[model samples]
Target: MSHENAKQQDLARATTDERAPMSTNQGQPVGDDQNSLKAGGRGPTLLEDFLLREKLQHFDHERIPERVVHARGAAAHGFFEVYDDSLSEFTTAQVLTDPSLKTPVFVRFSTVAGSRGSADTARDVRGFAVKMYTPQGNWDLVGNNIPVFFIQDAIKFPDLIHAAKAEPHNEIPQAATAHDTFWDFISLTPEAMHMIMWVMSDRAIPRSYALMDGFGVHTFRLVNAEGVAHFVKYHWKPKHGAHSLVWDEALKLAGADPDFHRKDLWESIEAGNCPEWELAVQIFDEATAAQFDFDILDATKIVPEDLVPLRRVGRMVLDRNPDNFFAETEQVAFMTTNIVPGMDFTEDPLLQGRNFSYLDTQLSRLGSPNFSELPINRPLACVANHQRDAHMRHTINKGRVAYAPASLDGHDPAATGAADGFHSHAVALEGRKLRERSPSFADHYGQAKLFWNSQTAVERAHIAKALSFELSKVATREVRVRMLDHLQQINPVLAAQVGRALGETAGDSAAAVPPSAASDKADEIAIFASAVSPTSASGRLQSTRGLSLLDGSQPASAAGRKVAVLAAPGSDASQILSLRSALSCAGAQAMVVGPHLGPLTGEIAAMATFANSSSVLFDAVFVPGGAPGVQQLTEIGEARRFLDEAYRHGKPIGVLAEGRALLAATQLGTLSGLTATAASGSSGSPAATLEAQGVLIADGSDVATAVDRFVATLARHRFPDRPLAAQIAA
Candidate 1:
């Protein structure tokens, strides 16, 4: 049959009955779909069964190779809109300058160094890649949650990933860097010091994809209509502000729900609480960049926000989830080279390497040069080119003249000249073709120290504990000591804190020596010594304002927060309903967790059960008044444990009237503000009794005031200053 006849028949079948019969790939209807063709009931199958052969063959090749990094990901469909034409003077790109056009976008959030089956809560760098289908073309802003990367040069990427991945000998630990190989590489690569500070901090374990900031790690150039070029760095600031999960919470969530981040993103969008981020850029000129002590081309560094404040230009809202995971999220490709007309690349070695690597990766992973023809990847702009006839080609050419510059077709599909189309920025180049790194990229520990100095006391402690936990897993003593020496360079206090946990001392003579002790050991130690010694030219800001997660600049709002309302038989249904209603009004969610998934006392249905829920999953916990319900909850071990865990994690806790009995049953009774006897004053107003420890108690009558105070406390996220030493295991 001719191709046209096959196409017509397929279209005719599409207009048939609603419940059509299943057909083969070739449109042949299958009658015996339940079983493969066989000679007899217990006989051997024959090779002549084309139906069985075709089905089995296709099933055998269902999966494509996963990415080497960022193998696990979740994606959503979205639109990006420029706030105004403010960026027009800097860039001629329509997507960045046109306020009326809502450019369609598909964004994929992923976990780096993890396989497709890895847990989402792993303490790893998160990939935040956005592919925008603009009128000009498809522009992919591939980046990560962390602003700075581990390595400055792209050639070291493979080595970095290989070391970070599970050890090849046993592959015992999956999706984790708390191992010997990773630390060994990091300890040797002094350039990773700054990134190590970030990965060890709470930033690595983000509370949710929507709560973390995204960054275009490498600096690029923005070219205007007048042919002026400026250095630019992109940032995606979450509208709700960046937040992170505690280490204990992250560890528990990894086992409780491997898809925690993915589920949160999907549900948030579905509930109409769409995730939004403001697109900001730090624009600078070549002269301004030259003044910075650190090299602007270094991927391992960041231009302090104070040095060059960000300019908010637009916003991106992910309002829709993908229809299919594999078709859109898994197969979608993002290349660093994908930029619009007004964008151009820099000579940053890491950025330069990514430009070549990303395209090659797509070719290898997608198994075809025509992968761009995939519906998820195809740009909205009209495509006109002489290139054709690759594997899986979708477009058909009309004229016989497929080649360019042919008079027979009037030189059709010609390239647009510089003024009308994409043009490279005019950058003069002068450099030798020798393998060398820029000296300006040195002083690796200065910014690392700056990060250490910027963090709050609690944040610094958390960083120390995280580093201790990771290094404790490294069985090799030399690697641990070497890492300690590097940490000492960042901060003596930080080094001492981690060293105490490791039962070793930082700056010891043994640790100062190179671990390998090669013939060039003296030279290696000298290099480390020189790299760590801070100089006036290190560009080290004593303290960066936004480096800490607890910075006062974060928006304190209860929106999108989740509170678990504990309920039992004979619980105060009115108070429960009132609290839920108030929390909903505040843009928060209140899920009633009971012993069983059914109506409890007063016909109040439970949305979650104690057995299926844990306090680590919630931002706060609340208990309502009722003698029988309070007594019942006091007796239930999980109920008591839930309250205990919530208190131990520094989450907000609220109790009213008889509900204090349940609080007394847990170890939280020993805490200063959360004691059962603390509410004896009989104050009806929750605000009057609000504790700095994040505990609220009041008489059951003032449900409105109680919810208001609770929501306000919950907005603070956590009271880390609470005495955790008094906490007991739940």
Candidate 2:
């Protein structure tokens, strides 16, 4: 359609909708919404204009206070059901054991320190909290991407948060740990070593929430039908395979698209590719817990998956996105105490504190005791409770006898019996009133070393480079030294490598955070570090089966991916036809790039046209052997920018004919694997050239092969070992 016709259509649609007229609050008709009531159009408006005042007043208060932590979160609504009612042997939670039951669930995924406005691609711990509304009650499994936490004790949470957030003096850096304050705190707290190593690794910056693995950071108790108490940890394995963006890619994505993660999620759901996760648990008896080297209650550690494999219990699939982001996603509350009968809490200090903290925080933030009455927070089960009346109370009480014990009032809602009621496991407490860190919680380096050992070489290199980049940004020498010391405690080589990356020496590391001390349960440390091969790449991922991302999720295909085909105003007609058909057969979306978004007036015309889309928007690019159009591509900055951006984004490129010559002339053509060969026909144009498998050059302008190769490259997202150094030198 022409621009003029499009504008006319828009005007006509606007005119059709105008019949209803625009109205304001209180049913008042507005003469204008674009401009306020001004004294003389452009002059200052009078304060007496009530409509403008109301509009501005409402607009000013449009945003509510964001969460103090995890303010940035993406939410989805879903339903969960157990694979079997076999859990009856474990607990009396009817929902867990009832095969006919289906529970409603709301899940929120977030970044810890970032504000709601922060970049989605920042290197930070991701929060994965799920609210399961069961027949018994609401149960919230609040967790993080990494299994461990920064601090052992809950008392230091405030200080830890403050350091991780912006500096107190200026509050300059937002949602990032690349500052002096964070390093200073981490250097001071040895317990924080394990978590620090993780955040510096690739796991912290996952490709999407769909690809991240979530863990309930604290160990909890799962009581069976026989009232047998077992210590357990919950985990959510993504139905999509685990994957992460490169650190360099993440950084660029932050600037290029701050809403990258959010948009990806929204689009995925809109495309009917719903996200899913499998709920699993690591169960161990009380006797088993007593056998571990480190304290199971310590939040800053994980019972390695090898110790207890995840036993799948249920599956949660988020097939629907919320209708309203605020009411459903934002207002939905998750409380640690909202567990069913079968599930019970543990004395993991941080978990205990969080159970208390979440309710208080929600009370202050939501301004209500009745927050559970909110539609999103409300359970699918019948809610019969005595708790009522504070902040927007939506419920109506029936009886005049509000007090419990009454002769006439039959509705005395107290505990009926232990059979159907929420029951706590009969575990005795024997601790005296005292404040101290457990001797078992002090072994910080053991698991830190284990995590380091588990990583692949690429993962380790990424971590080392990340540490160097983050520490290098720390202007304070002492802070850098402190971080260096922590890294040294993790691994000497890691520390030394980062030191070289940051141009520092180990001797200068700030006095080893109150001086490293020995742990009481040092024997526990030995168990984790025993006879483990550190260099094995197979163990780094969840599975050794190819580490293929196409697993768990959809199959490999580039049907919807846009492919750019470069041809001139006067290129081969039959070539375009055969090439387009081949690409179309491959399920790729092809667009012809000629002089402009204009038609390709070549010999055999086709349905080929262009839009204003840059190369950055496409999955791959193809430069058909059109030497005539090569000048148009190179001369145009947007066109060249297309090639450059694609290179940086790591998309595939295919060039042929004089197209290769044009690439060689410009910076884009000299990229790795761009080897030129002779064209098949006697056109004297080079075509049968091997660029990269991703970047293909056909045998004498065999457009079909270039299209086939483009599809293949899209399948392989990136080429990590590209000979970029050689290409740059050329």
lDDT of each: 0.85, 0.70
Give the alpha carbon lDDT tens digit for every residue of 237-348 in model 1: 9998899998888999988889999999999889888899999999999999998878989998889887899899999999999988888998898989899999999999
The per-candidate count of clashes, in order, stands at: 0, 9
lDDT of 2 by residue, 268-339 (tens): 566666677888888888777787667899998888766677788888887678888988778878888888
- Candidate 2: give the clashing pairs: 90-224, 293-524, 663-669, 673-691, 679-700, 680-700, 687-698, 688-699, 688-700
Which one is best on lDDT?
1
Stretches of candidate 2 exceeding 4 Å from the true structure: 1-60, 94-102, 412-418, 507-631, 634-673, 676-717, 725-730
Residue pairs with clashing backbones, model 1: none
Whole-model alpha-carbon lDDT for candidate 1: 0.85
lDDT of 1 at 143: 97
